[model samples]
Target: MTAATQPLLPEGFRELEPYVVDWALPTRQERYDMRLSKDMTELGVFYDAIAPRAEAAIAHLDTLDLDALPEPELRLLRLLFSMILVSYAVNVFEQPSIPDAGAAFFDTLVEPAV
Candidate 1:
């Protein structure tokens, strides 16, 4: 909580091998469900900060493939991600207040919050 040192996305996402920056893809469905979803009891705190429309969009989202989701969901995902980034821009970068199942994915230190 002092310095706030958790990375935002994955190492490859920040660095990238390929196709990582595409906004037309949904993040992994399980990961997305874990971080968001009010109907689901996990209710990650980061989920609390998301735009309500994005949350609704995510819930009804239909999967296209592992590499992609429907365009509507993908767009909503981008909006959700933008909200998260904004918080990191304004607040400290700490572990996303997700459930234990979700937090395990991000371990590297994020850059200092602005």
Candidate 2:
């Protein structure tokens, strides 16, 4: 099957496929950049979609080997990671960015392998 015809997320996570294009980023910096680019409304939308399914998603992912997750599972994992980044904005900051911080950015030099 062609890339477009292939599934972007695991079977159980088909509902989240809509978000994959925007939120299922592979790296910390990419996710962080995404978080910074959106407003509270957008971030909240993503948070609400994933929060309820967090436990189930984790359970599903735990069944797989982390070092060798299939592409769809890896995308799901990335979506989970994006959810984590969005939580801070939706729950804590109540905004898309850190308050009182000016032009600060994360220079992520290291990230765990997926």
Candidate 3:
């Protein structure tokens, strides 16, 4: 589809991501449990496997103090974190929606103040 006819993502996806990141600290376990898709779609039963893994990882993460984290651990964290992020970006934001956001942007911006 052309830029003018592309769809936009659900707004909640944008709002939820940072919140999810914040939860990565204290509610790490819960957030891990909630690591559904970008839109939190039910992608079969085994899709929830990442949560416990995150919890287990965090115990080790707490020991490192973020400064002395080894490259491999960091890489794994990045990979897991990105998976969470991309779930939102691709599945939520990039999912099909009503086209015309570009038009809407221009329409809202170009219109005379009312």
Judged by lDDT, which candidate is best?
2
Displacement of the residue 86 alpha carbon in candidate 3, Å: 2.6
Q: What is the lDDT of residue 70 in candidate 3?
A: 54
Question: How accurate locally, in lDDT, is each candidate?
Answer: 0.38, 0.89, 0.39
Scored by TM-score, the top model is 2
lDDT: worst 10-residue window of model 1: 11-20
Off by more than 4 A, model 3: 1-52, 89-114
Clashing pairs in 1: 6-110, 7-110
For candidate 2, what is the total of clashing residue pairs? 0
Q: What's the true lDDT of residue 49 in model 1?
A: 38
Number of the candidate with higher lDDT, 1 or 2? 2
What residue runs in model 1 are displaced by over 4 Å at the alpha carbon? 1-50, 62-66, 93-114
Q: Best to worst by lDDT, what's the order?
A: 2, 3, 1
| Clashes within 3 Å, all models in order | 2, 0, 2
**How high is the lDDT of residue 46 in model 2?**
93
Candidate 3, lDDT over the whole model:
0.39
What is the lDDT for 65 in model 1?
50
